[model samples]
Target: MQGRVIYQEHIDVLIAGGGVGGAAAAAALSQLGLRILIIEPGPAQGRRLAGELIHPPGIDGLCRLGLLSDRSMPGSPVKGFAIFPADKDDPASSVTLRYGEKPGTRHLGRAIEHRILKDHLLETVQRFPGVTAWIGARVTRIEENPDGSFTAMVRSNDGEEIRIRPRLFLGADGPMSRVRKLIGISHETRRYSGMMGIEVEDTHLPNNGYGNIFLNSAGVAYAYAIGGGRARVMFEVLKGADSKESIKTHLGLFPPLFRLDIERVLATSKPLAAANFCIVPNASVRGNAALVGDARGCCHPLTASGITAAVKDALILRDALSESNLDIATALRRYSRRCGRLELTRRTLAEELREAFLAQTPEALLLRECIFSYWRTSDKACVRSMALLSTVDTSIFSLATQYGTVALQAFRLLPRWFFEKTVVDWHRGVLRLVHKSLAFQYAAIRQWLY
Candidate 1:
């Protein structure tokens, strides 16, 4: 294979995977006069429904890449989010978060089709003279030279193996990043149960412009408007079975969790199923190679922050490279220091937030309700939580502050909860609750603070 292969060199940066992250980085870097080679395994446009919700910060990042203009991509404008506890049909039990309510934040999130945004970014990359995009090309392997450059083996569209030697290598290859593995950057990944999504049309939700999440005993159900009388509906399903069967069989397991007709919606549209997953935080840069997007780290999908985080990574990395004279080592160090802090806050919030809503234990259920109830009363809580979810603010201190308020609310409701349960040793129970809350808070904050 080596004897037959053609070698291509003098490339400034080689990007693996031309998804949003890779394409955005190519566009940003090419503008600086660097020759970029982006290998994409998929077709020219993405087809998955995974990354539909672009939070406010993600929109800002797109604008920075010059992808956004006065004329927006075809999608719905999302004002915020609405969360329903247990009974999705009960409007009174729901709490809302509006992005406009937050200070110093963009007023809307864009709920567009994953393919639309991806194609738009790829098109933007093509407009740049220095970017060479090869769709249907896969990166087979990457080798680092002694002088800190890289040689990559790519299987191109016509099944020809080619070698590319580039000054820097970027892995925007998503959660299962081959570049990360080949480069010897260790990471941890776990796929949670599973989730099913269906495209809905001609039906509007109660909070039409806001992403809707319904919490119940079975699992979590989510729906958001995408635009033009269409929406995306997602729900948790049992793991390890035929996804379609799981969806059909388990759809009836829970009560009507949303305003739409569940059976009608599922029957009318094809379902997209995926397992919920988490990637433990790791350094974004290693040696001459660095990772962006899900390659670096991923939060639980429930946060809907994955896309925003990926775009942010690309933007920050572009800034670092531009400022550091294109020195891979210096640029990566700067990116690492900045993204490390952001990753800490994101991981902590994603973990804690998942526990508060999705955990199955009775105690966890109680906490979920308490937190929901707290949000209903606290205006600031709603805005701050939205800020974190939208990635508008990725500060651990700010996260601690918001969660501290939740803790206080939890404590205030504990006594009444105990009294209603007719518990023996109620005082002891309260003390235990307080001790546990403080310990959990300390544990979460300690990791980020250090």
Candidate 2:
């Protein structure tokens, strides 16, 4: 059976899923005077719980592309992050890590609502010349031509089908991307945890203008202001835990004032729930087709680096195309090569951070203490950590160095271990640390070289 045909169009690029990555790519590629068509499957008013807090690098990328402006986008300014240690009742025990302490970093991050941010981005991209977007449309089928191009069939909300033939096809349809599957790319997704988010009004944070992270036995809980008199609190729900009960259990971990606010919001509204998972694609590019944003890969939100990584992907793709002089094959290869290491670092860092913060095992708890000690003792350590977290520095060498430093800090507990524990336990801890340190270095070096 054939569907109703609305119109046929020829474009330079066909972007699937007009979300953050697609909008960013359209805005960036429109500068090259290319005709770009963006088809979004979801309606314009669709509200999905997704990334709302963006790091400094993402903020800079959006501003650089002229898609985001302080005056145009109404959101809260996040200077940095404030981390409260587990079992610590004193507010004074919290450690604050500020942005811009490192060179070449933005002074503040932004925390807009997810729906508002997506709408603003879509609106901004649609205003760009040579860019067309279909809000309730989706690419249903993609056919590859022998000459290295794609013919995509898009169906609108009303069932009207439009055929598009473009020189380049980008898959930005997110973690469960249909385009990625259509392009025959295999990906592995691992479920880490679950997250529940609630928005509260007039909440007071221990440190204003910073994201507050409260460490707990279950998982990590995050609280930060999103906009005018409004704040967002997210609780990480471990596997097999009751979502509502988990959130209620974590609420008391926050400061008294913030705890009261969360209770009030809980009484008034239901929290939005989303799964936290990571996807690692076998490959990001094949022939003239490519994957960007979460379509390429994603990590747990413990790092809050999803939006930042997506923006960077767009910028890197733009640079790759320009450097390759718009040659589709060469540009895709360049993009793949440049993004491979960054994705590896992001995924690995997110996994390690989550493991350390959650601290289910003895070694993990030790590593967590060492991390806190490192942050407390050295201002430079905080800057470096923030730099890595902000995505301003993606070098695996820097990551290895930081890991080694943290590992060495763990070694300082050797004497205490010998005094407080059995000799066998001390020996086992030493062996485990050594094994982990070596394995991490080996992986980092191999990944860097490859």
Candidate 3:
């Protein structure tokens, strides 16, 4: 519409990268009476963070954007998830914390646990009459014109580069985005420090219906349920925790995990956190462009909510654009302001939690002990903590405050030494026997009596 009429008769919006974020934005922009183009780098081969525990807010956004309904027309639905203290030594010692509770705005977020789930999303994109999704096309470069339009240089899988000009071009590309750099945006690296995300499929864990968190004293791992009775095991190796043997030992701790014996899954998964933690600044519309999803930034995967965070950004971006006229600057600005506030809270809390889990001190040990006791007993505290992570609290700060209050209350109610012995000296002497007795009862109730 402004620079060259190469893309369309009247190019309105162009979304680069057709992952969840790009597709969601494209669908939203269509409601604004704009023709959309979604340029995805690959076909079904699009590489994404495969393990997703799509939370309630993310599911609600999908419904609102007309992307999915009750049955996940495109993807699948998961009831909820469970969190384990990843640093713990024993699988039986896991605290199965479920994010969804009974009827409320806060329910268990359905998880999309595999790469094939992308097929459902891709199918929906294919059927969207108002949008064009050019799959297997790689976007190599972008040119922001003086008058505020964009010229994207996209290369087909066959090495043919085509230039298309669109009024508002978005880079929904993953963490390594050229679009942000072209705009000269410098990102501040946060807490990625020294960690890597390795996703592998394990077939023996259908009972891991939701995402299962595993945090040993060394690092943390997350397992999300996928199709075909499969689950993805993501091991986040912390600083100085990067030996193949260490990973093997951690996997050995879970008897259920070992039964699968799927070593190939570990060998293939990509490591994202190997890069320094950074959030590109001024990623919003510099002139008439938008940077959505990980092209903007990503936090640690400890929350298992990165994919949802990206989708939420798209939803908010769409809302901002649709509600107001296409003054691209204002719209993109809104996307930045809203997403920053929203993601910052999530990321900050996750970093804090990760740090605490990674710490090896008496206070940290005490906290870990308390959490594990609940894991052993399946208590109210576990339920409440799960609720807080999903959508119940809404405010991250508030959630922490509430959890602290509950911990204090639980301490006052239960005998201090009992919790201390069971969690603190968990593997030795009377505490070991005490936990053995209590753990047996828990196993029975969870297995038989519910």
Better of 1 and 3 by lDDT: 1
Please provide, for model 2 over 16-111, each residue's C-alpha lDDT reduced to its tens digit, 9 standing for 90 to 100. Answer: 988899999998898887899899976645457789889989999999888998676678988878888776556468888777554565778989
Q: Assess the local accuracy of residue 253 in candidate 3 as a C-alpha lDDT between 0 and 100.
A: 50
lDDT of 2: 0.83
lDDT of 1 by residue, 282-326 (tens): 567777888988888887777788888888888888899989988
Lowest summed lDDT window (length 10), candidate 1: 251-260
Put the candidates in lDDT order, highest first.
2, 1, 3
The best candidate by TM-score is: 2
Shift in Å, residue 429, candidate 1: 8.0
TM-score of predicted structure 1: 0.89
The lDDT, on a scale of 0 to 1, for candidate 3 is 0.61
lDDT of model number 1: 0.75
Q: Which lDDT value does model 1 have at 363?
A: 55
Please provide TM-scores, in order, for all candidate models, with all chains considered together. Answer: 0.89, 0.94, 0.76
> After superposing candidate 3, which stretches have Cα over 4 Å from the reference?
1-9, 44-49, 72-77, 86-91, 100-106, 156-161, 190-207, 239-242, 256-283, 366-384, 391-393, 403-450
Task: Compose the digit string of candidate 3's lDDT tens values, residues 289-393.
Answer: 777877777766666666677777777877888766777777877877677666655655566566557677544454455545544554566666655455344
Q: What's the residue-level lDDT of 392 in candidate 3?
A: 44
Show where candidate 1 strays beyond 4 Å.
1-9, 44-46, 88-91, 100-105, 240-261, 422-450
Clashing pairs for model 1 are none
